[model samples]
Target: MCRLAMKTASKPFSPFSVLEAMEAMQEGYDGSGLGLLLRGLEFAEYKYNAKDPILSGIAHSEAALARLNKIMIEAGFELKYDHEFDVKRQMIEAKDRFKYILRVYKQSATWASLSAEEVENRLMLTRLALRKDGEAHGQDLTVFSLWPDVAMIKEVGWPLGVGQALGLDSGRITSRICMAQGRQNTNYGINLYACHPFFIQGVATMTNGENTAFIPIKDWLSGRGFPGYIGYQSDSEVFAHILHYVTKQLKLPLETYKHVITPLKNEELAAHPQGDFLRGLRDACRRLIIDGPNAVIGTLPDETSMLVMDAKKMRPATVGGKPGEWAIASEMCGVDAMIPDRDRSKDFQPMREHTVIIPPDRQELQIWSQFDHLPIHQAA
Candidate 1:
């Protein structure tokens, strides 16, 4: 009935490996679809030093491919690598198969002086533009993510079988952070764009429960005057965009995102020295507040991975690891599959109102409390 996700500290493990972990917890998900996003990729060595955007998606037809090529060229993007998924090697085939394209773009000289934030924004707009173009032209194009050091693969199938079908070299194809979601169709039809592990710019998020506050949140975000905020295939996609809006757009600290999405009670806020400051933020972004019973796992642009629960903590999540590696998931089985050697007693779960932030270095875990006035307590 929910989704699952996991990430490592620094090691570049295979995305297929992540898929396997999700497969272990498959009982909770119906496997209507599978979505994978990888950052700090190991297979594409050139991408580490490459300064351009790497975009991947499913192109529904040959005309869609031609149109995409035209759009990219018109936008002053020169292709570095253009590839098609090798469907011949896959284990299963759908009644309607989409041609998967992964292209790395070398931006024109005009983009040389763009700031890091601007460059990221450009990639996002480019990807969203492509999706919109595809839709307008009657093409089923779904761009997963467009950025350097990233690649995404998603399809409608079983998790384990989809993993096997990729036919990637397990040793070579890896990333520092990879997310997989075994989707259970609840609201939307079986659209590939509706799959979870949604990514925008560098922020990626997957949720394990339905987001009851999605419509108001979506409406608020769409009104923010940003072109990239138009799509809403999955209600959970708003979480990913909110991460971008909070950290990149508003120039707010990452912790503030937790508060914006799930603000504390006025009574709890009154006890803190920064109570008024927090209250102003809640009032300004009231529509963004989430109604939970949702467990969220996400990765930020700076490589920080996070695990958060809504006020009720209706969905389960566990964070555990040894010294150099830590991971979070909606189930203990997921964490166990990622780092089985770690001491089980050390596993910690965030309570109903806490955000557990794990940095890339994996040196320590930082728990941010919405209820800052009270002492912190881990879920037992």
Candidate 2:
């Protein structure tokens, strides 16, 4: 099993707060690896450069770094600001392999002339091309994300130790939302690309539990002819892709995501008001149905955060906090560590049939059930 924690607030706070919550649940996960995704960045420079895309990754050598620069330049991207972590050798494992990088880039001169859809497609394609070139030459270059106001850091080591090495403990890397995972290596080897909080376009997700239906879902996603869906380093990566496909590609509402991935049974659908529409969706997205004992936490491009559970609800998770602040975690201990003063009486543990949603405004939490009525016109 693995541990997951998320922190969201109306204003930006240090990423260290989320790491501290993960530390509280250390017993649930081994110190194999740590992955973090920070969105709604509050860096001083980002205030003025919010439109630029920020590239986050790790380069194994100087040659790999040079190659990345060359690729970005060739793709019509201009470097704006570069921020590389001063990784502490003594604090982290595998000192030789952790050259962390975060750089901002301005799009090409013609970027302003493209449609919204065209710009999104270009960003994803460029990131995929960079990943392919790096892998082909064994450059040990990994690109985690290329989006505005988002930064992802992943490394192998204890949660806090890795956070310290990445300079997260300094309380400077702040964001309005942060999702992190303390990975417990179970099936796969420790590969940095296989870390949690997988990202594509603007959709990001991190999950706990093995996805038994990974291959089928991955195949369906790749066949859709999208370049960003190529990497399948982790079974859970498909969760993010599935989200991107449903919301971005298909242009569906956020609630439709839960319907696609964990559809209601025929019997359960019969009880819903939009049974006919749901039945049709179930048939159309059959291959995307996930089968496994998993709990997922993710954020949408608009900053909406969600916590979802599989039909069986085998994994543990909780959501708690007061107004203007909230936290979701794999265990209650993690929540307590983040906001001890929260109203314990109002804490919620979503059942197998529920999806807990917190909109970008951070005002209230909405719990939508699989049996809830969805307007057919919204999906139409």
Candidate 3:
């Protein structure tokens, strides 16, 4: 009964309450340019004022462009107020505006002198785009990735002076923002239907005392369920590359893996199943390698088998995939990305893999999922 109560206590007041809170907080900090807190808040208000979602979203988006200009001034970038972002119809239709913005940042937007405010904007944008885990979620179900780099800030002249915010990549940052904002104005990381955003299991990261590295796993994190332990393999980059290559040797796409590993539609998965075998599960992934689908087939223990069985059904372009929940970081010294692949593929040649499908609206979900599982104190 105490265990049941514990679970009940963990439930949210209402499904949308988390989103409301997130949006409210976001709206409360409206600033332009590097002050993403400010811009996000204003953007939230713009959405709240709308009568129609489609139009409201557009309104908020237009305001973002306007805010981009304001941010330029606030950051003291080379933009001038008499500026113009010559968004061509064809270019807009293609939905690739980052290059265009960078090409004309100074000429197409507002200009000003750098200030603490610009530094502030740069930092905010950088943090939003660089973090390893998702920050926004809905009822802690649909977790998604936020930054893979920093196009949104770069396009607008990288408001955050801190190296373009989130590790120096234009496309990565834009993808992060686009994912978080989605099609609606304020999804704000709430899991509505126990779907993708509510849960996922892939590469994640954590720092070690001496170095940083990746922990690979056929992770089953989310509203979904699978049997296994959380394991550590190597440093982050090496782990990422191997899993990618193994998925290629097999025919599974990443989405298919997500669906199976952290499924929503699969009736086969039973939530909160009986078991206290977590410690054993966690220890299983210590340095496991994938040699190829055929060779890797029977090598794993039951936990590994379960993870691989599901992952194999819907895999990505990877050669070495561990079975568990783990994250990877670049600084893990005991690891190198390429050799793991070499070992995994030495026995066999890699074959083509399926493609993964990524939608634009899953960012808020990813951010939310990252913290939902934490203890209240950890969350804070």
Candidate 4:
């Protein structure tokens, strides 16, 4: 599907209506909410314009929070503080729910008000609990037999088709091909395929991001010898290209295999050979290609399908058949960090780059909630 045009400041942003304002009040960080807060803070005479207004707006903020809580409660929430509930707690809750308004308003207002360094510094300070990580996924990976006989691949004209198939821009799709492969960010998804079908002897390391066809070659395959495409770093391009045909285009059955695994000392190596290892590696990729999409059902989907639950079907947060209200943390990651014995990230792989976060629902009201609760102590 074509992506919606992202709102930019160069063109006039349409003025938001009352309905938009009400929705922003509910969501906390919508365009209207940002507009309201931007006009409020940008025109403020207060020294710490950001914080002071929240205290000034607290009465309205409290009313908003009360309504949200009441909805949650009527929806069947058993509200109580886990530790102790202070009035400050409500302010913090509302502030957090709508923190993005502050961010969007900042952007809409301008960097002219802030130093370059201050802008950079503000990112970390503002979103304390946001989890920063990176993830990768793919669609319709297919493979073919290249074990004994080498397979030949043909480069088809500009893979705009591939881009559409995988939900990416045609321009981005075009840049990847026939260019120096670079990283959009280490966090981006990449795609690579064969320029020409040639001999396949060893592992293929394909890449896509800054470029369409560069792969990183490590000396791990020393004995494999200098093979085809002497200019490329890794053979992943060849491999992934082959996979595109075998798994996606042809839907061929592939013999999945692993190329290498450690712990193959005299003891472990005694049971397995080099060929067995490669097969294991291939099988692993195949399984992931098959299962990854299903796993992201609740997290992300290629297509957005709003499962509008019947108003009566959805219930408030519950436990043991009791209505239990939930406290969403500073961010989704924070909530994830709260599960029992959940030192979830301690041993987990740190992302090579920061992860991106997008919310499913409009959150402007949540941001407005924060403005309502900005603390007097934080007042400048």
All candidates' TM-scores? 0.92, 0.96, 0.21, 0.17
RMSD of each: 3.8, 1.6, 21.6, 27.6
**Ten residues in sequence with the least summed lDDT for candidate 4:** 291-300
Error of 2 at 343 (Å): 0.4
Question: What's the number of clashes in each of the models?
Answer: 0, 0, 74, 50
The best candidate by TM-score is 2
Give candidate 2's whole-model lDDT.
Answer: 0.86
For model 4, what is the error of residue 72's alpha carbon versus the real structure, in angstroms, after optimal superposition?
Answer: 67
Residue lDDT tens for model 2, 1-380: 89999999988898888899999999989979999998888665444366788899888878888898899998889988777565687887775564678888898887899997899899888888778877987847888888888899888888888888778877656889999999834577777888999998889999989899999999998898878888787899999999898889888777888999888889888877887888898899999999979999989988999999988888989999888899999999999998899999899999887889999988888988877766447534
Q: Write the per-residue lDDT of candidate 3 for residues 208-269, one digit (tens) a residue.
A: 11112122333321112321121122222232223332233233333222222222222222
Error of 3 at 316 (Å): 4.2
**Per-residue C-alpha lDDT of model 4 across residues 1-380, encoded as one tens digit per residue:** 00000111111122122112122223211121010111111211213223211110111233343443343334232322111101223322123221111111112134348774454334322221111100011211112111111111111112222222222221211100011111112222322222211112211221211222222222322223423222222233333333323323333322211111111234433344343443344443332222100000001111110100111221111001001111111122322322223333321211111111112231111111111221222121
| Residue 293, model 4: Cα distance from true site in angstroms | 22
Q: Which residue runs of candidate 3 sit more than 4 Å off their true CA positions?
A: 1-64, 75-100, 103-122, 125-312, 316-380
Rank candidates by TM-score, best first: 2, 1, 3, 4
Give me candidate 4's TM-score against the actual structure: 0.17
